[model samples]
Target: MVTLLTGLCCALAMAPKWALPKILAAQDASTESLGQAPADDPRLAAVRRTMEPFGPIESIRVPGGDTTESLVVGHPGHRAELEVLARELPGATAAITELWGPDWAQSALVVIAATPSEFAALVRVGAEMPTEVAAASVADPFVRGNEPTGQRVVFSPDAGRRLSADGLGTLLRHELTHIAARAETADGAPQWMLEGFAEYAAHRGRGHRFAEIAPTVNAALRTGTLPEDLPPDTAFTGGSAVASYEQAWSASTFVAEKYDEHRLVELYRRLAAQRQDAASEDRVLREVLGIGRADFVADWRGWLSAQAV
Candidate 1:
């Protein structure tokens, strides 16, 4: 079981959709050990010093089997710690061996190294975001530089390997929706709509969780705070965080249910293409849905309320 960490961007927070091609390298079957033991080298000492700031140092254990010494930086936020590690380790080839996160706690990132030199280098370089914008951020952050790491899938290891088949498809559908929506422009997008669209894409034609209307309606009924409408700038914080996602998913679903699928795609395409424009989303929404964002919000809220009762 992998421990997920905080600071790592989830679907709600990442600004762009990143995809990478998988790489595969030919291996020498007889070359059993992938790691070389460190020679009490001064370089390893230097690398450790660089990584000291992120969190508590529980232990820096060497990797078992053919793997090199592994650095397990405990309690550090995944994004910051990994970034720090990347900066300290400028290795020849570094691979993410495993990543796990608790539902409500920070995540753990495990990396594998083939040699002391490689391990030292990886820890040095892990702190920086990839130079390539395309490799920026994802659920999985492993990419083998410009070279292919391995290829069961077209995307980088970050994308293609993190989830089970169904989960991968769901995540892909959500990410692809961002591509369609162009929500990742300089102007940015409202979180509710952004996540809502992705959620709709992920669960399209499937029986609804909120649509059974049990969870949301019951919550709303209990709180007397069921939202009739949502604002655009919804974020992943506070009570609104979870509620907003539920509302957005349901709202987008309502739009899909009433409108054509191709229309939604066109709406996203138009919005994405005009990402630089300040008014692009509204313009696209008006043109595609024959309604403004405000009107659409009202309608969706009304639809949600009707479903609840």
Candidate 2:
């Protein structure tokens, strides 16, 4: 069986429900009929309280046509919050459905339940998560939307237990980046680039630049640990996986900074076009950047060494 692993919403008349009901009774009627007060629940209350300073809460909904009774929280920064959330969590389906202005959505969204106390809400997000993608274990393992529907975010149990804004934002960025590119490049793309792209996007939004870590990567290269070429499937054993990802992230950051964002997309597109993955990627890089692998590596090393120490 062909395994299709991506965060894009597969178009279907029905959105397969993503829930493992531990607390919610299976017999409870559909959300369309039983939409309850979000304020009653502690989680929803917390969400509401956090959002209260900005505006009132509004209804949250899922693609399944279920509406969540919520308070609409509208304020200046809320819109940016949603957009940032949307950008950072690209794997989830999200939309600023009601845009009052450039940065404002009519309501601050807390989907699946009227309140956070609903265990099923968390379960539902978990259920929608694409299990095929492997990421580090995080609290409330969630994803941001990647498709036109908006950001599709998944919040695992851990997200609620000890949620810190910084950590949540990082997680949001990582998973959402998954949502953004999940549909475009899954078929023949390299996993290292896949993750590297997401990692780069996540950190970049947070003002963290890979250039800051170039020295570390350069040191690895000097030790002969860095592969002359990007690591390939045959080389993807456990020994190389972690290091390969770091290198790929470094290379991706370098490309984005030295070249441009479109160039990164073009590089992936070219790589996907060729049947041979690594060779295809190299060809694309050489064609676009006009540098051979050896020269590119040497230049990259020198560039790393010259960065602001």
TM-score per model over all chains: 0.43, 0.48
lDDT of each residue in 1-309, candidate 2, tens digit only = 011232221110101111111121123233343233345644355344434543454432222113322221223323323222322222222321111011212222332222332222332333433322222211122243422222234333223223333344454444445444433444546655665665565455455434332334545655554456655543333455445555666666777788877676566555543344545555766997877666766765555445433
lDDT of each: 0.38, 0.40
Name the best candidate (by lDDT).
2
Q: Model 1 residue 271 lDDT?
A: 54
Q: Count of backbone clashes for each model?
A: 41, 45
lDDT of 1 by residue, 1-309 (tens): 000111122242221112122212223311123233243633334334534543333223323323333332222222232222322221201211111011111112233222233333333334332211111112222254322111110112232223223333344344333332222222343455556666666555433345332354445845555575554453445444545666767766677777866675455445534232335555677889998867876787666666653
Cα lDDT for residue 161, candidate 1? 25
Worst 10-residue lDDT window, candidate 2: 11-20
